[model samples]
Target: MTAGHLAVIGLGPGDEELLAPLARRMLDDATDLFGYGPYLARVRGAPGAVRHPSDNREELARARAALALAQSGRRVAVVSGGDPGVFAMASAVFEAIEAGPPAWRALPVEIVPGISAVLAAAARLGAPLGGDFCVLSLSDNLKPWPVVTRRLRLAAEAGLVIALYNPVSRARSWQLGAAFELLRQVLPPDTPVALATAAYRQDESLRLHRLRDADPGGADMRTLVIIGSAATRIIDRPDGGSWLYTRRDVPD
Candidate 1:
């Protein structure tokens, strides 16, 4: 008997238009879908796929369950909001394959790429990530707080444009404040910061703030907080709104 196959797909940042054609095709072929609830609801036209929606931070269990379905001759698709590889289901699926039941290793697995939230945020913010950038998750659920804080400090010191994901949630609210505090130690108080909430969804709001003046109240689980590098700057637009961008060239 032929074993089932698993496809990990990225649905993009809350917009149907942003989903890739290949990902849509895979969803069409899948018999089962597994993902966070909100992300699973985005698969509008997949007629026969059975969806298994779980709460946040349950990635490993979800990956294992999806793989088991695949091993049992059902084509399974694991969906994530952004690129699955970016703090999403792709790594969880791989981690399952590595340490799961040995039979799981034999199943065919594929990952379909999608536009990440950071990229979507960058486009909305006038390309603040034009130079070297780093994406970090502020949630310390999987790692220690010291480690997260250390990386925040090091990334700021290195002057890399930083895109912070999962900045604030119900159980963990103070991390964003602490992150801003650490960044302020190495970065100027007036450094440009863009908080892109709900990137492509309805109620989307993108606001520019100085590092010192950044308001944690502007962020939620759906937000992508982008802290600009030292070289990043804002330009007042002739039309109306301001543009935040990092120049490609560096001073001699």
Candidate 2:
């Protein structure tokens, strides 16, 4: 067995402080790095390391290329914005391995997870995810819209806080509005929704709104929308605004 391997690492949510120590070490130790251009730009890699920057849409191809490099006895790193396992390169790499030659499966691959968008946003917004929650990506690139809406309805019906990734993009702007409306059907008008954009970054913004009044227009590609369950509450701050949180126990 070759000592060369693949390290799939997460850089965290656009903030270097949130980047995990193991992930930072993996990036510095990598002989090669593969990821989207913007995500690759965020990394400070080894001086001699080669970066294979591709468009965000080229996940599978990038996964295959990284796998090939790793299989050839190179220390390769596949980087993602947040936790690599959560809706990122790890899944893409696994999909490529599943369909690729059997040798690809034998390649040593390590998943180094870091702070996810959901966790980052939740931390910024207090304890909105203190209790049960389900994370979903609203991007319809691979899944059907019906499936997305179905899961949203089910999560709301079950009184589960919903952390939505990829809430709005140029191509899917309407989906978030539709999702908000769907959640409203199952949740209350006063349900708290936290819109966290570019969480932990210099441009980070966190806004809280009731489900009835939350605006879908505020979100962008970098936003993580957390919709609270029935058990979620808002505590008005003495200074101004409020903190959003979910009760650990659902009262009977």
Which candidate tops lDDT? Answer: 2
Worst ten in a row by lDDT for model 1: 40-49
Q: Residues 39-81, candidate 1, lDDT per residue (tens digit)?
A: 7876764687798999877999999999989999998999888
lDDT of 2 at 175: 92
Error of 1 at 131 (Å): 0.3
Give the TM-score of each candidate: 0.97, 0.98
**Ten contiguous residues minimizing lDDT sum, candidate 2:** 1-10
Regions of candidate 2 where Cα sits further than 4 Å from its true position = none
Q: For all candidates, what are the clash counts?
A: 0, 0
lDDT assessment of candidate 2: 0.92
Clashing pairs for model 1 are: none
CA lDDT of every candidate: 0.89, 0.92
Candidate 1 Cα errors over 4 Å, as ranges: none
